[model samples]
Target: MLHLRVIAPEHLREQVLDVLRNEPGVGNLLFYPGVALLPEGDEITADVARECVNDVIRKLKQLDIQHEGAITLHSLETVLSTRAHHAEEAAEGDAADALVWDELIARTREDSTLTMTFLLFMILACLLAAIGVATDSSVTVVGAMVVGPEFGPLAALAVALVQRRARLARQAVAALLIGLPVAMAITGLVTLGAEAGGWITLDDVKNVHQVDFIYRVGPISLVVALLAGAAGMLSLISSKSGALVGVFISVTTVPAAGFAVVAAVLGDWSVAGRSALQLLVNLVGIVIAGVVVLVLHPRKSLIPRSVQPN
Candidate 1:
């Protein structure tokens, strides 16, 4: 089922509830002072039903006596009407609150010029990527990818764009800039160490030349990064959190970072530069695409409304 937020003016609430109660598609209505949730429908096939909801929301906003109620709709991932679920429900609220707090930490720029968390993430991501490349293991590569803190900035970029928070944008950009270099450097060092241990060789660097990773910066790369970015933004808006992991794998950011160090260690300057380019291209594509998708989603009122913490 789908979820909706309806806002209405104080005096017209009775009329609003009357209309909502009689609304054919609406299943269950939970009345509140200024806002309420309604089970929109079980059958949502195409654009027609969606338009109907939007139209209803628009009409209700007009009758808003005290405040023109803006209507927002979202997918309902789970439902628990029981009292135990209610206590358990607070778990999601706590987690969301924690996320908001973390966002603040990530978004806030320290006056000291560099943040410890950013630096730590960069170092950690780079080291992990280097280990993966050295081992030539996809498992390790994925670990490195997941370890890479780039996702935070990427998500932050979307949030910044949606809220028009320039400070957040700048902070995210800064994190990317500092994080990439630090990560690459750490991997470079790791690569050098792996070389000394005879784990990775110049042969591996040369092989990377023939390998077609996402960093080639062609139309396909651009398209994949764009799709990943859009999907990432959508995941954020819709609260389908599983998609976030897909976002990491969908883009070439982590792989490029790994390849950059491998190339650097083998003195394959060409490969290093190309991988760097690939990283930059993917990052730019994801950021721009994320910004655009968020802008579009909010306008369509497709973004899930963040509930106020009660």
Candidate 2:
């Protein structure tokens, strides 16, 4: 369930009440009039089922509450009230199957932005992956995969394409296009420095049998990427964040990028090319799969007719 806190303008108070009161998915509605000093409006709060939140938010948006006042939502970890149970039962769909698009778009927008912290994580993840590749350590490679932050932008890119949000698409694309190459270049330079300093050798790069999967691109690679992409998107929508760790380890994007740089530094063009191909395959497969999943499960169908825009 979600707890909605709405500050409605004086004139729109009755309209907001009508929407909330008429909805079968709302429980424990509370209203406080002349209590909002900053917004100068009435403060209304309600506990709403997850399946009905999208419609409620849409109705609130239609009244321009965001502009004239404010609307805030919080996920409830536990609801003990009978009314809450009734609300969920009365909603159109199961909570797990419900898709809250506004929340998702907001989340992806924040995650897709290219920030200093994001770049640092990218570089660090690649560096770890490079070491794992050099030492032929699958464990270290897995750690690097979990550490990589590329999936956020990839997911965001998929959402942007489906939603047709030009600015969001630009942001997600910029993050991916800029982040991966930057990490690869930095890792390559570091690998070269390590080689010169006697920390690593070309033989180490050539003889990594245990981690060779990072560079070997095959049909299965695309298939795994496709599955991971779909799983990741579903996890995001369902709010099953724990499932994301499995998604992270399932794809070899970060490790492949790291291995490509390491192989290039060691003067193995053939291995580097194959590693790059692996990275490309994973990226393209994930994006395509994500787009397909989003297209298949659209948000419009979940919206209640009473809240849909005319």
Candidate 3:
């Protein structure tokens, strides 16, 4: 279930009330007139089944409440109301099967942004991967994968494409186009610095046995990427975040990028090219898989009526 707090202008309050009254999945409605200070409107609150929230949000958007008012949603972790239970039971579809478009778009928008934290994690992951490759440690490579933030933009790209949101697609692409190269450059410099400080040697890069597969691109890599992509998308939709950790560990994106950066640092163009190919293969596989999953399970309209423009 979800809790919604809405601030609607006086003029639109009636329409909002009507919509709520007609929605079978909403309950525990409360209204307070002229309670909003910033928007100078009436405040309303309600409990809604997760399966029906997308329709409610779309209706509110159609009312243009976002321009002069505010609507916020929160998860109702523990709902004690019998009315809420009835509302959920009355909803048409299961919550897990319902695709909350607005919530998902919002989440992807936030995650796909090229933030400093995202950059730091990508670089750190690459650094760890570079070390992992040099020392031929699969465990370290897995740790690097877990720390990488590349999946956010990658997932965002898929979501945007499936939703046909051009702006979001561009943002997601920008995050990747900028983030990956930046991560590679920084990791390469770090590799050079480490070598200068005698923390690593060329011998470490050349003697890699266990981690040599990081640079070997093949059908197996594509298969792993496809499976990881599907699992990642499922984890996001199901809110099973722990499953995302497994997706991270299963893919070769971060490790491949790390290997490419280290190989470039060592001037091993052949190895660098192969690692780069592996990275590209994994990225393409994941994006294709995510798009396929989202397309297959298209978003459903919770409400039949379109939101009227105010």
Candidate 4:
């Protein structure tokens, strides 16, 4: 369930209340007259089932409440009331299968931002992967994959493409283009320094076989990437965040970038090229799969014809 708060202007008060009253998934509706000062409107709140969130929000948006007033959605960790339970049961689908489009867009938008923390995670993950490649450590490579932050922007890119959100698409692309190369360059320099300090011998870095799967691209790689992308997007939509950890570790994107840089530092151009290709194939497959999943998501209209936009 979600807690919905709305501030409706004087003229639209009845319209807002009517919609909430008619919505079967809404319970505990509370309206406070003239409670809003900043937006200068009446305040309305309701306990709404998660399954009906997208539909309710769409109707509210059609009313221009976002421009004239405000709308806020909050997650409810626990709903103890019988009314809330009935509301959920009355809604069209299960909360676990709900597709909250606005929430997803907001989440992906935030994650795609090119913040310092994001870059730091990318660099650290790649560095860990470089060490894994140098020592032929599959476990360390898996750890690096789990730590990689690349999936966020990749997911954002897919969402942006399907939604036709130009700004978000640009942000996601820029983050990927900038983040990956920067991480690679930093990792390359560190690899060179490690070799100089004898922390990693040339033979140790060159004799990588157990983790060669990081650079080896095959038909199965694309299949796995597609599967992971769909699962990741579905998990995001259903808020099954624990599933995302598995999605993160299933792809070889971070490991490929790390391996490519380490190989380049060792003057292994052939291996570096193959590693880069592996990275590209995984990225493209994930984006393509994510777009398809989002486009095919079940979004049957739950709004009444009267409330829906013409």
Candidates' lDDT values, in order?
0.60, 0.90, 0.88, 0.90
Off by over 4 Å in 4: 300-310
* Estimated TM-score for each candidate: 0.59, 0.92, 0.92, 0.92
Q: What tens digits encode model 2's per-residue C-alpha lDDT throughout 38-85?
A: 989999999998889989999999999999999998889999999888
lDDT of 4: 0.90
lDDT of 1 by residue, 185-244 (tens): 777777778789888897766654224463466778888888988887666645556997
* lDDT at 268, model 2: 93
Residue 240, candidate 1: alpha-carbon lDDT: 59
Best by lDDT: 2
Instruction: Give candidate 2 misplaced runs (Cα > 4 Å).
Output: 298-310
**Per-residue error at 241 for model 3, in Å?**
1.0
Show pairs that collide, candidate 3. none
Local error of candidate 2 at residue 119 (angstroms): 1.1
lDDT of 2 at 136: 90
Model 3, 1-310: lDDT tens digits are 8899999999999999998989999999999999999989999999998888888998999999889799998777799999988898777766766767777778878888988988888889988999898788989998999999888888899999888999999999998888888988999898999888987776777788888889888999999999999999888877789999999998989899999988888778888899999999999999999998888764543443234121
Q: Which prediction has more favorable TM-score, 1 or 4?
A: 4
Ranking by lDDT: 2, 4, 3, 1
- The per-residue C-alpha lDDT of model 1 at residue 175 equals 81
